[model samples]
Target: MSDSREVVRGLLRPQFREATPYGAPQLDVAVALNTNENPFELPLEVAEAVAGALREQVPHLNRYPDREFTGLRKALAAYLQAQTGLSLPIESLWAANGSNEVLQHIMMAFGGPGRSALGFVPSYSMHELISVATGTQWIAGRRDEHFDLTAADARAQVQEHDPDIVFLCTPNNPSGTALGVDVIEAVLAASRGIVVVDEAYVEFVRPGTPSALALLGGQPRLIVSRTMSKAFAFAGARLGYLAADPAVIDGLRIVRLPYHLSSLTQAAARAALEHSDALLANVEELKSQRDRIVEGIASLGLTPVPSDANFVLFGGLSDAPATWQALLEHGVLVRDVGIPGHLRVTAGTEAETTAFLNALAAVQR
Candidate 1:
């Protein structure tokens, strides 16, 4: 074991020799609330439709999938138009296995040695991980104590770094609060590079919160990424997409492996998009439960960061790690997120939420 470990350390890339793979602890618990996944399974009608589409593709598996995923792109464009009221040309759309891959593709094309990527700290950790993985320099900017980014500070950092790529995560992870369009616009106005806005949880955002999709028009360097995982309950389908200028899409096309999206993935995603209305019907319920978590945790004297996404990040824990372990012993799993005094929980089904709150209450006592 010692010799094998030494060999791996010697052979792997210098940066990755000590890096850990990204994932949550896959644990068996009565109620799991980590990872911010939509708690509902697909509606039966949608499931049947996706299965039927995949069934039709089985016989054609011997051939590669449509390299451009034309049909899926059209479906995605229509869905985004209806959802955002922005009619974008299909040429502006692109997809990969997941939103992380979408980020990776952008990095591959635009970010490399000597190119730098800037993201606000305590935002999405993946923004840093993917940047470093692509050999792009990672620059960590700061956020306010409440996890909010001000337009002035955002512009200042962008100007100071002059990064080749800037990442903005709305309704950011680990904190679950959202950014306004002004913040995004400020970054765009300040920087000379590409701006990638990750909206992985937009469907669950509270009312009146605008999306960056509204800003994509006339901004050739802006890329808005979305996922079917959170709202469409299609995480298992591994489909994530983005909208950008046709030129950005073309650049990503150059770096993408041929036939990168599998035939089954494309079919499943399109079928799921066909039922976007039904699949998203539970957003209200999830939002309600998310609010419940905020109130429930606050009622117990823990300060939950206000959330627009389906998860809540709460602080005021005297010892977050101990509380996390206590909740696990009670069969409820949440994320510690490595923050000093905060833990994050996904808003699950009503019953699951109840279990989490109850477990925390017990731990508190």
Candidate 2:
């Protein structure tokens, strides 16, 4: 009789409540490189455009937003074409609240109960959570120290699980190493189902390195998801899109809720697209800063992985949990990667980078 409902819930995924590293901060600090966020504030022009769009619209919170978000989709498609140099039809584009929701749509559309999803270990954590939430099994293949996607290893796992969907997070979340385009093509060629390339950090990479988006035509089963969150300085806006064949987009539409995006969100995203050139310029700056951080970590006798994204993963101290706590005590919050002694730190503003670097030095000493 006492809380029988709560008692009925026998347990939860151990990882769900496993005291993971997130949101640990107290006093206001001048620098915060824990979360991978664009250090630059939104450009004045971009902010004004977003505000102007909202002002032009009649207050219509009473009415739902455009269910399909067609206009915004077209804007995004055009922006992507400019970025990736691929002609993308609006029908080939799908938008969601963020890459997270975009990812969920992919899982819902292709993976379900009894299906399986493939991912690489030490990659994004969301892939596992999304798979579990959708009642699909998540299978991970371990990567070597370099974080390269070994074709042989991937092929063996693909053959074993025959997953309904595969996720490739380029410039991978923790390691920040991007899988080569050729490696990605090989995966799609070998994959028996959909292959999703999450290019959430593409902006930070060098231009010559190809994006998975460039391989869309060569591989019909490929789906490339990008987010405005990191590079655009719009983590708060939460706008993300997936580029795929029209059929793939249509499949996701079947599973998405009506009016998945609010008009304000759509307006903001569209406006943000107008200033992508400026936003990407900041990305170049971040890349330089990231290089500095990586080199600094290595010079300190730590092993820093080669990174092409907004963050870097490094190993120095033997105990990650203790080191993470130590860094926090010094007012530096960082991502505590579950790897034995690894940590991920975002490339923040110059000031933030200095704080992280100084804190790391003090902690290691």
Candidate 3:
């Protein structure tokens, strides 16, 4: 090893020896569907509102924001109440830069050297990454070949590990499997620690699907996290929030930095929350495109995992990496999520989805 490499390795923790920062390819391509982002832009009125909110904050930028983020918390609570009909108090709401940061706060508060976290594999890799980064032991749990977790299996594993934190990702990442409430309840009954339901893509779920937010009442250990990045079409704003018991929010506050949320982020998110109804209209359109990808890939003879998320995880490639490259050559980019014969693609605009389906078909030929 080079002298610089040797010195850095010796200075860092044992886990830091070979860890790479989390990211996907940032290539310039005609179509980008790697990240499961809402493809729609903000409505004109909402954009103007955000700009106006920021303008109002220019004078107050000299002062630190409310350390408690009181106004933003109220806005978030209102938004959640409108969406879920669960009228949680402002004390039960919390916000951070992204869902990832919200999760990091959870880990810092509840997970550490002696404590551990458990998550089903091929789910959100960040659950594992964040666990390790926080000095928490990460236990990789199991999933069936279809990437689905059953209530019985989940209960068995929870009983086995008895970890301090458990992550259950609904409409799970990469595989796009949506766990039923039965599975969530089973895991909760079995785990003695925190249970986080990552609902970053919950907005795109098919009709009649239930959100875990409904389970938050009388469930102090349960946390339901949501992001503006996906359904709200405010990915660029980097706002993610969660609803839990007020006591759980108290634990996060002990770990969060003072004024961790900026005045600008608070302003932008509150403005966005005011026009949330108009912003979320685009969710129906994206859901339409998501279903189209599922059907299109299935008709092309590939296997698509039934998705309630904005992305589709399809299988049947002999070489997923080669197929990903081939699709890129056809001017489309998709995620090769490290599964042996499967890849994931985000649903974009109508033209973007058509381009992906066409490019995928051409590669198969």
Top model number, TM-score: 1
lDDT of 2 by residue, 1-365 (tens): 55663454336444454434434344465566767888798888888888898776657777889988999988998888787678888988998998999999999999988899989888988888888878888888778867777767777677777788888888888898888776786677778899999999988886677798878875679999999999889998999898999989889989998888988898888888877887666887888889989988987899998888999999866898898888887887887767887888889877778888888889889
lDDT of each: 0.94, 0.83, 0.92
* Candidate 3: stretches off by over 4 Å: none
lDDT of 3 by residue, 1-365 (tens): 69998998889899978888899998899999999878788899999999999999989898999888999989888888887788989998999999999999999999989999999998999999999999999999999999999999999999999999999999899887788999999998999889999999888888787899989888999999889999898888999899999999999999999889999999999999999999999888888898999999999999999999999999999999999999999989899899999999999999999999999999998
TM-score for predicted model 3 compared with the true structure: 0.98
lDDT of 2: 0.83
Which model, 2 or 3, shows the larger TM-score?
Answer: 3
Please identify model 2 stretches exceeding 4 Å from their true place.
1-5, 8-28
**Candidates, ranked, TM-score:** 1, 3, 2
Candidate 1, residues 79-104, lDDT tens digits: the string is: 98898889988999999999999999
